[model samples]
Each structure stands twice: as structure tokens, then as C-alpha cells.
Target chain A: MDPSQVEIPPLKDLTIENITENVHLINSRCPNPRLKYLMKSLVKHVHDFARETRLSTDEWMAAIQFLTQVGQICTDVRQEFILLSDVIGLSLLVDSIDHPKPASSTEGTVLGPFHTHDAMTESNGGTLSHDPDGEPCLVICTVKDTSGKPIPGAKIDIWETDSKGFYDVQYAGRQEPDGRAVMQSDDEGNFWFNAIVPVPYPIPHDGPIGKLLKLLKRHPYRPSHMHFMFDKPGYDHLITALYLRGDPYETSDAVFGVKESLIVDLKTVTPKQAKEYGVAEGCRLLTYDFVLVSDEEARSLREKEAMTAMEKLGLRMKLLDGLPVPDVD
Target chain B: MDPSQVEIPPLKDLTIENITENVHLINSRCPNPRLKYLMKSLVKHVHDFARETRLSTDEWMAAIQFLTQVGQICTDVRQEFILLSDVIGLSLLVDSIDHPKPASSTEGTVLGPFHTHDAMTESNGGTLSHDPDGEPCLVICTVKDTSGKPIPGAKIDIWETDSKGFYDVQYAGRQEPDGRAVMQSDDEGNFWFNAIVPVPYPIPHDGPIGKLLKLLKRHPYRPSHMHFMFDKPGYDHLITALYLRGDPYETSDAVFGVKESLIVDLKTVTPKQAKEYGVAEGCRLLTYDFVLVSDEEARSLREKEAMTAMEKLGLRMKLLDGLPVPDVD
Candidate 1:
């Protein structure tokens, strides 16, 4: 291309058809290959989304303000942006893409805003919930490899909402965390904890994401479930949940975190059986097993997916060259 | 659609193919038509962008964090999100879509972040610049309707950078505004002001937008221009600029706000001519005319465009229904 012959296409009088193409070409000289690709793709999609909706100036301004409010509301303890991501299903999608299951391992779920570190290590069968107005329940689980070998001393970080459906952080007065504990599997690869049965709860509705949910007439309920993070040396850390089988929102969880393999049944135990476990009469008991994948396998799977993704991106880039500009008149 | 025969499709264990569909169905109960359409379309495009990019979990989180920073950086006087919008061309696109131009009228441009109300009214041919080191220039303009009729009493709000290419905002110590004034047209529809010829300058490069431009290997210089807002009783308010011809960045404005029709030539004045404006010998002069469209015509054009946009969106919705879930495998 001769410098004297260079055609300076007027970018000022833009029409709908050429806007995306011009945006795509604007930052073609970005230094980092990945960042450039991401930025270009972002410009294309965001611009197309607006054009596809014929988004008015008023609507665009409203979105900008909403995002500002969401950002302003975030603090160290609260992340409205993450909540926005989760509610929009982006969180779960990213999780699935990064962690492809090998058919035998525990499925991934969304790490909701309620998750907090509880370093208090509890002995097997110890209580986690301290709320008086809670129904007693026993959680029993074994950590094992995909081949069914016992993985003793695996640390299990667990949390759940109280029976009334509120996390410890949501309470006004409590300082110490409740309904949360960290326990390790015994020599037999068994871990058990006494706690109140978790119940479905509405996410915080005072913020921008909640307002958007309200506008969508969408319920913000996450199904009754116990949050669990299982980790041990030389193994992949698994973030998952044990959702109650019959919970009303089991299939309609607002964050789309439910998986068929993660849903477990609860059985009612007699008072005599409960006494042996040092729990109250008619306590519910849930028993399940978690299968961990090896860290090597997880890494390999991620690499495979990344390669496939690059190939797909390559294909999309070709189509970007002959982009169709729809007639605006 | 009998209740007894209602089938419950499993929402659990969703693959990439079905996730977007599930999100589309998640809020089927939204009562507002436009909100529903916007939300559904947003889900489709956002999801598609992620899939097309094969976005990693880390990349998605980084985007969320970047957006949060953009939001947090905004204050009453600063808006980083709007800056982001301008740099990405969304702001200009929205402005163009909302304010379509008639064939005989002046074009619109982005209302940049430097815009502020200049309540200090000045008579024709008064000085607007106060910097002692500034070069002298004369600005003369006439406000007229599309039919070439002079529009008396039309208010022209003008602002420009100093000779060194800094707005009053770029100065840290000044409280009183400089380089801006509101002047009314005379009975013959003429407005003139004495000021320095504006120089090209980089936008605030200390923010996230600046960092992004650096990473993209892009320059942040806006072409030298005078910001003008013309308003009258029954006419559409026109926000435009008189960009200097042959300016280095005229064709490559950082914000893509330059239009060929808005670019005007500057003529160097003789010392005798400069004496008439009480300016230096090497001062410049620019003469231009702005044609405004009636409010009613602007409204009719917007309505026609709205109908066309709806038809386009309707067609896109049909394509979304048969959305080709590409073979990601």
C-alpha cells in the first residue's frame, strides 16, 4: 500500500453497517495477541448487542448508570459484579468451560456471594449450626478418588444457610461465623457433621442486580443446598454443592448451579439412631460420596479445550473479514 | 398444552448448546415487553461472545474486575464508563441513531466529557480565552434554518482548548472556567468570538481508557476543534464541531467524532485584519455557517428509524430462534 494512495475512510459519518467493522479495525495494532483478540471480540459483540436491540440513548445511559451503581456498591465483603455474573449465567458458563467433568467426578456449581473462609477445624460429627430455631440434621460424606480408593485426611470446607434461609453474614449482630466449618476425613475416609438442614433463600434484593431481577420478574432463590469445597494434596480442588432432592428451586436455581449428580436424598432417622450420633430426635441424615479427579487430568483437559477454542476463534476470524453490513435504509 | 401432559425438561446438567436457551427461558415471566426483549437479546449475544472467544474463566473474571474499576473510578465530576463508551464507538453510534441528520443540516458528534454549562453570556465578538500565552484567533459563525433563513437570538455555546491543547478542566488550580462562553446571534444571525486556535491534545491518559489505548498501540489525540452547541426555540439542538482542516489527527480522531462536513478551513489573517479583532499579528480566522433542522422533522425521522429498527430486530429474533449452536467439539 502506497502512503500517497492511502484512502482515509471517513470514520465520522458512520452508518450501522460499517460501525462494527470500523471498531474491529480500530485497535488492530494492540501489543498483546490475547488482549487484542479479546478487546476486538468485545467491541464487536458489545456494539452488535446494542445494534441488535436498536438500543436507544436513554437505554444505554440507564445501563451505564446501573453498572456504576453496581460498582459503587461493591466492597471487600460484597461483590455485586460477581452476583451480576452469576445471575446472568456467565459464572456457570465459565466454570463449565474451565472445568470439564470426566463423567465420574463431582460436578461444579456457582460459588455464591455467601462463601467465606471458616478455618475452625471440627472433629467428625461435630455441630456447625448454632441457631436455636433450626432442625437438626447429619451430613455424612466420604472423599475418594475416581477409582474408589479412600482419600483420608482430605479437608472439607463446608457451609450452609440456616433453616430460616439466611447465611451468617446476612445477620446483623453475629461476629463469629455460624453454619460453617472445616473438617477433615478420618482414617476411613469418612467425614460427618451435625447441622441444621439448609433451605432455599432469596439473594440480597437491595442492590442493582436484584433490581434487574425484579424487572425481569425472575425469582432470586437458590435451592436448598450445602456448599462444600474438597481439597487435598496432589488432587484437584472441587467446588460443589449437595442440593436437596425435593427442593422447590432444584431445577430453577437463579444462578443455574444445579446438577443432577449433585442432588442427594435425605432420609429421616429414628430418635434412637439419632442418639448414637449425639443429635436430636427425628434428625435427617444425608450420605454421599465425592469423587475427585487428579490435578494432571484437569490440567490436560483444560489444555485440550483451549486448543479447540483457538481453532474455533480462527474460524470466526475468517468470517469477520467478509462481514455483512445489513441495509439500513 | 394440557397441564397433565406438561413435560419437565431437565434444566440440570446443561451443556454449552442448551445454556443460552435455558437463560432465555429463565425469565419468561417478565411483564415488560422491551425489557424482556433486551434481556433475552443480551443473554444471547453475551453468551455467544464468550463461546466465540472461547473465553477462559480467568478472562471473564478480569473483565468483571476491569468493569468494576471503571465504575469505581467514576465520581460526580468524572465518568470513566462514558469514556469507555466513547472510545469503543458506542456513544457515537447511539448519538447518530438518536439524532439523524437531514440532508441540508449540520451533522452531530459525541458530546465529550469536557462539556459544561457556560452561563456567562457574552455579546458578539467578545473574548472567550484568558490564557496570556494563547495565540489569537477569530471565530465567526451564522445560525440558520435549512431554508437559509437567519435565526436571530440563537444561542451558541462555544468551548475550545488553549493554545497548548488543554481545556479548563486539565488545569488543577483554576476555579473560574476558561476557554468557554455562551454568545447569542445578532439580528442578522451572526455570532463571533475572539479566542486562540485550539490545538490537538491527548485525552486524560491517566485512567483505564488511557491504559487500554497504550496497550492497543493507539494514539489518544483528538483533532483540534471548537465545541459548539446551537439551540433555538423550535429547532433541534445541534451539538457539533469545526475541526481544523489538514490537522494530523483529523481522520484518526481517538473518539471517532470527526465528520467531513464538520471540518472547516482556517485562514491566516494579516496584522491589519488582526487589529480589528484586538489580537496578535499572526492570528487566524474561521468563518462557518450552521444549518439546524426543525424539531418536528427530527421527530419524524426518529420515528421512521424506530420502525425500521423494530423490523431489523424482528428479523434478528427469528435468526436467534434457529441459533446455530456451532460444533464446539
Candidate 2:
């Protein structure tokens, strides 16, 4: 059929139809070759969603307002909107989709929202948990290859919430990086630290994400967990967190970061066993091991680790480096 | 290669191959199909954009901060982020791509950030310029079918700025509804109104978008233009704006609402012709006619119009109606 021969409708009859056609055109214009297909697909889906929903003028305006608020609440230190992604499961989903760990190793989990780039590194056996008030516990882990060979000189980056589930940064002045630490495994790939058994606690509920969850009748609790990242030469880097067995929210963490493989049983050890590790007996002791893949795998793992870390914390790209970044995503 | 024989990388190794792979899996778990796709696509492009730009942590964080401010300045009555969209050309591109008016008709333009839901309707020759303080001018437009037949009872929604480029809403005391009126064309497909010649003006610069322009060393001026929406039963609706023949920023409108076909000369008419139109001699006059396509073609046009409106206004589906709205085009 000739293009001109197609009978064109008048303006009054065209409001709905024009929207459909225009979306297709816009999809064709994206400059990023890699993103063009994805962006076009997204635009198609988004336009379809709008049409299917029969969105109204007032409602559309409201969405604009909501997003604006999301942007507004973000700051140098606060990323309520990123927290919104966590609660909505988008952040975790993105992490999992982007970084599929091998089925054999410990599963990774949400990075939570409190990671700081300025975490101070410590020597082997250094304890991150500075508070002496919480229940005393010892965490022991080994870094090794898939074949069970030890990975000597591995750096074990560790952090965790206090017994009450608060990060050191959450109480900058009052808390001195309590329950948070970075330590290196010994030449034998063994690492140990003392801290309190973290308790399940609610995520910050004073922001828009919290408000949205409240409106949706959802909880904001994350299961008790400890964060660990292992990196060494000739092996894949691993950034993961271990959840405590049997926390109330273990099965339903708000951020969906819990994995059965990452759960460890905290055994109550006697003083004799604690003395062998230079700690008192009757303290909680948890043992786990992280197995790394080859060096190529480690590089890929690092990218995945970084992306997850950034997404979970709602840390914008600007915080990664002081430069202007586009808001495409 | 046999699928089973393919060597599967260890969980740690997999992390190094592609960060997006991890994100893809999590996206699969999203309950909402739309959100699933959105999250997956967003992460992919965001990561890709970052990698392409070699984005650093600080730059990414700054982008987040910028977005946060965009949200902060937004309110029930004001949307600075939408203004951000307008300045970025994304809104116009989205709208034009979504709603491609037939090449023969007057191309649609940006709806702008100042549109209100309620513009008072008036009869033929009704005055919309409530304030008489600005320069005296007359606007005459004919609404016709493809064959040049007049379309009676056609609605013409008209709005523009005063000589100082101020809309009625900009000044609470000077005028109730300055330079804004909605009227229906007469039986002969003709409509006329008395108003002031609009001048070029700068958008509000106290918000985040303003800050962005300052950082980029760009200006925020929009050329003089008039808004129009023509609708009649059994025909398509035409939403557009016409630019003055030679406004300073006509070639580079901040919102990108200008189009060649929509630019018109505002002729200074003789006293006799002015008297015939009930205006004084030496008054500026703008005469133009809007030609609309049939219903089918107009549907495509309206979709584009809506998309453009959505983009220019920083509109989101959440604001629309709690239902998914397609924004692809």
C-alpha cells in the first residue's frame, strides 16, 4: 500500500493511537548500541503498561511527584531511594541477575544499606566489633580453593551489625565501628574474630521505602547476618554475608538476601574450646569456609561484588568517583 | 556444543564472567512481570553506561545526589525534575518518538511544565488575556478538515504568556488566568482571540535543573510561543504550540518544543483590518490554520503527544494510576 494512500485520521480520533506509534519511533533513536535494544524493549513495555493501566492525568502527575520525592530524599549520606529498591526487591534481583555465583560455593546475599568506603583495614586477627557490651561470640572461617587447598594471604573483609542490628555508621559518634572489622586470613587460610551474635532487626523505617512498605502491609525486617568479602591472587574474589540459623526473619528477609547455604549454626562452646582460640568458653562460635574459583572467575566476581555493593547501599555513581554521570538507569 | 558437556564455572568463577548475569537471576524472582523486566533492563544499562563511561564511585554518587535534589524540590504543585526532563531533550524525544503526527499536519510540540488541568472555556472571540497591561495582539486560527472544510463546534484550547512572558498563574494578583483561554471554533472552522504578544523568558532557575544548567555552563531560555489544543467530535485531537518567527532562542528552546511548521510571522496589520477584527491599528496579528488527519492516523499522533507530555512533565506511571504504563517509545 502506498504510504500516502493510507487514510489519516483527524486529530480528535488520534490521541490513543499516536502514543503507540510514537513509542516505537523513540526506541529507534537511542544512541548506545548496547543499550538500544534494551532501552527500546523497556520503552515498549513501559508504554504498554501505561496503556494497559489506562493511566489518568492526575495519577501520572502523582507518579512524577513520587519519583521526585525519591530523588529529593537522597543525599551525601542518605539513599532512601536505594533503600526503596532493596525493599521492592529490585536491588537484590539486580544483584542476583548480574552475578550468578556457582552452585557449589556459599551463596551471596544483600549487602544491606550501611557499607562505607572508608572502612579501616586491619591486620590478621583484627576485630572490627569494638563494643564490649554485647553477647560475646567468635566467628571462624577459612579461605580455600574449590579443591580444598588453602588460599594463603587472602584478605578477609568483614562487617556486621551489633547485637541490636545497628551499623557503626548508624551511630557515628556513639559507636566506634562496633561489630564491623577487616582482617586477613593467616598463611594457613584461617581467620577468626570476636563479636556479638547479631540479632534480627528492622531496616530504617523513617524513609519513603518504609512508608511504602507500611502502605503495602509489608515488614521491614532483615535477618541477623554478617558480611564477609574474601580476595586473593589466583582466585576469584567473594563478597557474601552469612545469616544466623533460626532468626525470625531468616525465611523472609525484607531485601531477600538470605540463602540456606549461607546460614551457619552458632554452637555454644565450652571454655576449653574457647581457650584453644584464646577466647573465653561458653561464648557462641560459628564456623564457615569460602571456596574461590580461578583468577578469571575472581575478576568477574569482583565486578559483580562491586555492583551489588553499590546497588544495596543506594550509593550513586558519583560517590564512586567525583564525576557527572547520566541518569539513564 | 552439548549443553551438559559445557563446563560450568564454579560459583566464584561465575561472578567474574558477567556481573549482569547475577542481576538477571534476581530479576526472575520479581512477582510483577513489568517490574521484573524494568529492574533487569535498568541494571544492565546502568552497569553498561557506567562501564562505557568508566564511571567512578564519586561520579555515580553525584548523579544520585543530583537526582535526590530533583526530588527534593518537587511538590504537589511544582515539579522541578520534570523541568530537568525538559532541559535534557529526553522528554521531547520520547514524545516525538511515541507520537509521530502525520508529516502533513502541524507537528506536535512540548506541552511544557506550566499546564494546569483547569483552563476556563470561553465562547468565540472570548478574551483569554485577562490582564490588559501587556502589548495588544490578536490571534486568529481556523480549524479545517483535510479537504479544507470548516469543522464547526471544534474546541480550541489556547494559552500564552504576556509581553513580559508571564502566565496568569505566575502572578496571583495581576490576573486571575492571564493569557489562557479555552474556546470552540465557530461553524466556519474559525477562532480568534485577543491577547498580548508573548516574549522570550527563562524558566525557574532556583531548582536542581537550574543548578545543572549552571554546572554545564548552559542557559535556560525558552523562545516565545503559544499553546493550542484543537479537538472536535469524529476527528483527532491536536495538541501543539507555535513559535514566534524570530525569537532569540527559537533555534535552541530549552524544552525543545519548537518546530518549523509551527513557526509563524506575527504581522502588524493596518488600522482598517484591525478595526474589522475589533482591534486597534498597528496591533500585532497571528493567523494560522490547523489541519488534522483522520481518526486512525491521529491515534498514533496522540500517543506521541501523550509521551511528549509525559517526558516534558517528568511524568511517571506511579503518578498516573497505580497501574503499569508503557513508556518505551
Candidate 3:
């Protein structure tokens, strides 16, 4: 197509009211219908946010600069954008919509910025924490289905902070992975790990997000929680964390990742039991059950929940719904 | 405030339906009312977008990584996020809202990604283009109030692409400015400069945003144009661009920056006339007039435009309106 053959919007017609429409007009040509809709919805929401806030030019530039800084600081070990999404609750919201279960099946939560993939693999009853400073915790979990069937050969990736409240990756010149490991569920669907009792710790606030939270007079802290990610063939992967029930930040997690079903108490275990559990003194026990959802069930549930979510949000979506939803999967 | 004393949303109640509310509840503690409102609105729209799209986990992660790459690619010169905003028409929408003018005054366009503060200052009728490969263009403009009275000593910063459609800054060499210069309007509000007739050019496409445009089957080319930024004390600073009328990308600018009023035709100047303007052979003359708005007038107009914009966007605002508009200014 000859570019000049396109209809041009006259300057007089490019008023603040119609500018977004004109933008959509140009974007309407996108060949991929799903991308077209995504762009349309994304642009509409973003523009609405700007107009609703009457976002000043300076503020917009500041946002651009802030986002740039967030991106620039990210590395293989660090993802500032994830931290941004976490602090703003976008991560948890996505987790809820994309991978969530309720009732007998366990629900999901934010994967968080501290998760890593290079964890050491171990069999059942593995040790995940190397930090001796933290109180020893024996974590026991059963991988099961909603019908009470054991999910054998399931892989569980878990990580947590030491007493110092820092991930091994957070340290300069990190050596081997510490406070993190992957373990497989036994034939009977049981997986246990001798680990440290994760404690409440502040999210890195020394970065731009920290500065933003500081400006808002908001603290940057996630409640004490050990991260867990479960995966198995034919079952929907679960990305979640178990919060320490009595952690100070439990109710006010900076990332909003806490949930009642996901919070568990840390029971103190005697030295003898700790020895039996193969953990050091000052021991505790963390226990929970993860009921995995099948992929088909998760798909149906996701579709059903999406329908309910439209009305639940109470956000204006009639216009967006009017647009065709391509195969988003 | 003690976090434990705070109310916690029970996991049963923390269904997908009420997660947003819980987030808002947590964010409600933000002492800065403006920041609180901003966060509230921002999170609402973001969550709405996610739910409306039923955005997949993989897609969401892709966006996260995309945004991160955009930020990391930015340097003192490059700003991928700004380009992202520009292509999405957020920049134009913000420009229309932030510093726009209507019938009597000059309407603003995007400042674009090429603008820099290090232009070499020149006198009236000075030359701005040093690239010998481009056809010369003589640019003349007068700065005046809406009443058409001359506003003397106004500063005009102008930049444009060379014949090859590359900004001086885009060159690999770390050299002096080539096609950019600052000029002072004369006592009679007349400012003239010799420059190259800019050609249509593609925005930097090797970055994440470029990849996105490619995925959407959208081209990255912006129309040929000259950037002009005018500033004077007590007057609202104007950032705008004048597009070449017949450029192939005129009607289909990638950034949606082409406006009818800002488009000007370039007339060829005779050899002798080119010398009179101190421009190279095969010269083209570009002419336009800029009408400035004083700070008082601009603020009033901004307020007026903002009110109309709320109605024009046709986005759901009733719910957003229920929230108190803290002193944003």
C-alpha cells in the first residue's frame, strides 16, 4: 500500500478527545488480531490512566526515566522490573489469574524476584539451606490431587533467605547456590527438606522502586516465606510460597503475596527431633499440602474465572469486550 | 503502625474477585494522598487490562522481559521506553494534553527521540546542517503571541535528519552536532536557519519495541520532519515538529506525530536565492509561524482541555472519579 494513500487525520480533528481514537485507527491495521486487541486495550487503559490523573508531561518523562532505570539495573541475577511488578502487585494479580486454584487444590502466589533456576537438585529429604545462622526448619509437604491421589515424581523447587534476610544471589561474587534447592517427591508423594526458617525481610529498596515506596511512606518488606514451585507432567505447575504465620510483615507483605491458606505456623522441635530430622539445634517444623490441578481442569477453571473476573473488577470493560478476543493461548 | 494490627484478607475471601480490593486496602496506608491515588488508579487499570485480556502467564512474562530490555537499552542518548510510548501514541496523547494549542496558536507534536540539549547556538539566519550529502532547506519562522504581536528574543532549538534519514547523533562517530542548532528570534520575532531537508526514517528497531512493532506487523518509519522547540520566560514552552508535506510516510507516521497544521511544503529555492540564504545548491525553503501561549493562558487552556478530555476518552471514569482527587499539583 502506498503510505500516502492512507487517510490522514487533520490537525483540527486531532483533539485530545479523538487522539486516542486516531491512535487506534492506525493500530487497527495490525495483522495479528490478538496483538491488535492487546494493543487496543493496553493503549486505552494507559491513556485513561494518564487522562484520569491528568498526568503532567514532567511526570510522564519521570516515569519513562524510572522505567529505564529499572530496566538498566536488571541482570541474570537481578530483575528490577519483576521487583517493580511485585511491589505494585501486578505479579500477584497475574499469578491469580493465570495459575490459581481454590478449595482442596492449593492456590498460587507471586513467584517473587528472588527465585532462581540454578538450584541444586536433591532427592526426598534433601537439605536446601546452607546458612547456619538461621534456625533450622524441617519442611514437609505432600503432593496430592484433589481426589486425594498422590502425585508421584513431582519436582519441587524451593528457596529462602538466611538469618541475614538476603538471597545467595544478592551477595557480591556469589559462589555456589545457597538456601535454594530442587527436590523430587517420593513414590508416595512426600517431599521433605531440612532448611532454615525464613524470616521477614525488606525487599531491596535501594533501587528506584525503593525510592518510590519511600516517597510514598511505604515500607519495602515481604513477610517471612519459603518459595515453592511444583512441576510434574500432566499437572498444572504451581508457583507459590508459604508465609510464616507470625511474621511481622505477614498481614502487610510489601508484595501482597500473603494468604491465609498459604500461611503456616513454625512449630519448635526439640534437639532430639531435630537430630532425627537431620537439622541443627533450635529447630522448627513447617508443614503444608499442595494439591495439584490437572492442566485440563486448570484451563476450564481459568476460562470460568475470567468470565467472572470481568464483572468482579467493576472496571469499564464493555468497550474492550466489544473487540474480538483472539486465541490468547 | 504495627503490621500485625492491620487487617488481613483471609485466603477464602482473597478470591480472584477481591484480590484487587485487598491490594487497594494494603496500599491505602500510603500517607501521600496523591501517591496513594496514583497507585490506586494505576493498579486498577493495570489489573483491568490483565483481566480483560485474560493475559496468559507466558504473555505476561514476555511483557515483563520486553519492558526490561527497553530499559536496559537506554543510554544517555537512547531511550527505548520513550520510543515505546511514542509508538503507542501515549506520547502524542500526553503532548495533546500537556502542551497543546488550537486554532489561533500552534498545536504541539512530539518532541521525538532525537532532541538533545547540546545543540550549538547560532544567530538569526545561521546554518544548522553541516552534512554536505543533504539538500539544503531554509527554515523561517516568527514567534508571536496569540494576538500576533512579535515576541522577541525567543529561543528556538531545531533538529532534523540529513538526506540519508539519520540524525547527527545517530552517527557512530562521537563528533560535533551536524543537523541541529539553537537560534534566537530577532527583535521582530523572526528566526531563520539553513538546514537539510529531512527525509523519512525508521525509528531504532533493533530494540525490544522494534521487535514488538514487527510482531504487530507495524512499520517503524516516521515521516520526514523538522523538530522545533521554542522557549521564552513567562510563556509556556512549545515542543513541536513540522513535517514535510509530501513525504511518503506523511499520512502513516509510525509515531502518529503527523498533524495537518504542522505539515509544511518545501519549495525549491533558485541558486542565487540559495546563496542569499547561505544554503547549498538545490535548496528548499520552509516557512511557518509559531504562536506562543503565556503561562497563565496555557494553564487555563490545560484545565479546559483536561475537562474535555475526560469526556472524549470514553473510558470508564465513573469509578475512578469516586476516588478523591488529592492535590495532584
Candidate with the greatest DockQ versus the true structure: 3
Instruction: Tell me how large the interface RMSD of candidate 3 is.
Output: 3.8
Q: Which of the CAPRI classes, incorrect, acceptable, medium or high, describes model 2?
A: incorrect
TM-score, cand. 1 vs. native: 0.84
Candidate 3 colliding pairs: none
Highest TM-score against the true fold, candidate: 3
Q: Judged by lDDT against the true structure, how good is candidate 2?
A: 0.63
Candidate 3 achieves a global lDDT of 0.80
lDDT of 3 by residue, B264-325 (tens): 98887789877777766776888999999988888777766665555575433322232325
Q: For residues A8-107, what per-residue lDDT tens digits would candidate 3 score against the true structure?
A: 4432236557778877777777776767878888989998888787777887899888898898889899888889888777888788878768578987
Better of 1 and 3 by lDDT: 3
Q: What's the DockQ for every one of the candidates? A: 0.37, 0.11, 0.44
TM-score of each: 0.84, 0.62, 0.91
Q: What lDDT is reached at residue B210 by model 2?
A: 75
lDDT of 1 by residue, A66-150 (tens): 9899989876557788899888888888777766778888887887777777547799978888878888888888988888898
The true-versus-predicted C-alpha distance at residue B116 of model 2, in Å, is: 1.9
lDDT of 3 at B121: 96
Go through the candidates in order and give each one's C-alpha lDDT. Answer: 0.78, 0.63, 0.80
